[model samples]
Target: MRRHVPGVPLQRWLLVSALVSAALIAGCSARSSAEGATHYLLTDQPTGSEATATGGEGLLRVQRIELARYLDVEGIVMQTSDVAVRSARNHLWAEDLAAQLHRDLAQRLSNQLEGVRVLDPDQQLRAPEREIMQLTVTVDRFQGRFDGYAVVGGKWRLLDSEGEIQAGERFQREQALTQDGYPALVESLKDAWTSVVADIADGLGGAWGR
Candidate 1:
């Protein structure tokens, strides 16, 4: 009979343990990579009117826009019902919600407001020597519904830096989603925002005696 080799058995046990540890490490690495692959989405600026030119209204500043507490998170929110919502688990915003909304709203207003230079506090534009009109939008309900409607609605106030109101009103828009998924939801939000901004433009123009 051959003599038993105790070291051989111990070595074999150590080898098996090492292999198992390596496999577990690889699995964890793969899962981490998959989680990191999550896609982020951003809002777009709505197409502005071609005929509307900046009628030399100087500079319009969009500052201090805000989002609702629930919708201000990184995830995209979906309205499940009249009082319920769901935030996307594997998707998020590429930028800050308030920041993106503020910038995009400014862009849409600038695009259609004609030669009127729309300035955001975060942007590089200079406030003109002309009277600087300030606007702040408080988004109370901005989210996509289960029925494929992207709703953007809230109260906005136009004012000067000194807090004098130029125009104040409540605005809302419901833009339909022709498709599904995040891309479609984003487009819907953009459309809704465009409509709302158009309303703002009209209101501001009227306030300015345009």
Candidate 2:
């Protein structure tokens, strides 16, 4: 027989093991929290019938349309709160409206035109091309009424490479209150822009000579 040396109790050992496990779990959670995260979502709207052409080459061709920097309009403004003290969503100022329009144009062109390529302003400026089409868009009005109606109005012009006006048109769209607040207003405005672009694209495509 050999003399047994004093040893730590099993209860203490178990407590130590549990504590270590808890520490490890906590550390892992902390590390995970420290890592940055990102989120991506699709925000494209559906295509509409306005872009459809009657009869053409059956196969669509890609084209580039240059956008003007500024437009002649009253500018964009948002209305958030109602006179009735109801909470209104955030209203869209001018910059937001412009940005949304740009995005919508890009998406629509990509969807309607095969192999569509939208050149950046900088890129277009640097590139040398024989002929280019320029689209000048102007927002004449974007506002919400006290009666809960939203409206958008604008004019656009298509110019050829020689700075001759090919075609120009004006459009206006209005809708009653659907959703609650600012987002609803924004959606309405976007819809109006989409309609206008579709009309313009169809009109311009027809004017293109083979």
Candidate 3:
């Protein structure tokens, strides 16, 4: 004869099952929260009306852009202190920052410089027969600061069709954020970038004998 074991009560079994399910759900929720990220694109805001072309005629090619190693990542960077910096884990660029900057600068320059066509060499729009001015930029600082400013610092070189340097200058600008948040930071950065482009346009005008 064998002895019978005691069975667990149905109520106790159901309670244990419920607790296990709840724990699993909680773990999954936590994991999802950790994995979720916000993506941002550095794009131009639409103007109410169409922008008219304003400058002289020429073919300008934006060559491949370079960025600092720290800025090569997708995460948005911030300078926390004089010696410390941090990259946001949740906030990231929606597109490659270097490519986006190249496109943005090209578009802005095209719009501001009348009669001139700005081409991104990466897009393969260059014509060998036509005279083309090449622009190469290397950005070292593109980030937010602890003092509520968005800083952009870089050096740009303009090369003539013969590959001779026409004009080269270091550009730096810091625009104060109107308020706080990533959106504000991005807007300020755009403003600062636009200013830099304006400076380039001025230089280009002088160099091109416009």
Candidate 4:
């Protein structure tokens, strides 16, 4: 039996289809935040380097440590052929590498500096009353050598509230990587960052009469 009924307008039908497609796409795109998350280490209580003089008196106490600026936190600005080789084996991307390094430093510093307030780099920009201390870290070079070795090195600078330079230092550390690829590289980088941070802390403490 043939029957005739009112039909939807062409424009109305098109809109309906578009809306339905969008809904489907949104539903499919939903993802859990922790799906591929990685954990990082923090230096809650850092010990002074052996080279640091232990007998220094009149150490000044820091009221706070602020990470007030990250205008130039570019991830993976430099890479080497060794990085490509390791990436192929470990399936690690440049962004992931940068993120892991950043997380490790943040956590370690937060733990090490107790009683002192730690400010997020992004949040520091909003509050004018608080003193602003900027720390800039640059991964100038990262490579794994063929002599059964891996090395990571970089430069960092600290600036005071008025944008005056406080202290600057460079560090490099290398270690032998096992079968693991990116993880090994990360570990080596962590070691390098630890050394660098300790130096910065010691220098700051000395400058402030601590």
Q: Which candidate achieves the best lDDT against the true structure? A: 3
lDDT of 2 at 52: 30
Better of 1 and 2 by TM-score: 1
List, residue by residue over 1-210, the lDDT tens digit for candidate 4: 112223644443343333233323333543522243233232223443212112322211122232213212222111222233221221223344554456555544455443333444554334344445566677644544433234556776667777677776776776554433335544555565677666656655454445
**Rank order by TM-score, top first?**
3, 1, 2, 4
Give the worst 10-residue stretch by lDDT in candidate 3.
46-55
TM-scores for all candidates: the values are 0.70, 0.53, 0.75, 0.50
The lDDT per prediction is 0.68, 0.47, 0.72, 0.43
Candidate 2 local lDDT, 1-210, one digit each (tens): 112223634443333333233323433565543553212111356564324323332222223333233322222233222331111111114334455566566567545544324343344433433355666667655554434455567676767667687787887877654655345555565666667778766765565641
lDDT of 3 by residue, 1-210 (tens): 112223644443343333233323433565644777678888774233223323334778888789999999877877755676666665679999998888777777776776666776865643355577899999999988765578999999999878899898999999977764677777888889889888988888777787
- RMSD to native for every prediction? 16.5, 21.4, 16.2, 18.5
Best of the two (2, 4) by lDDT: 2
**Runs in model 4 with CA error above 4 Å?**
1-90, 93-95, 125-130, 178-186
1 versus 4: better lDDT goes to: 1
Better of 1 and 3 by lDDT: 3
| Most accurate candidate by TM-score | 3
Clashes of 3: 4
Clashing pairs in 3: 54-114, 55-113, 55-114, 57-115
| List of clashing residue pairs for candidate 1 | 53-114, 53-115, 54-114, 54-115, 54-116
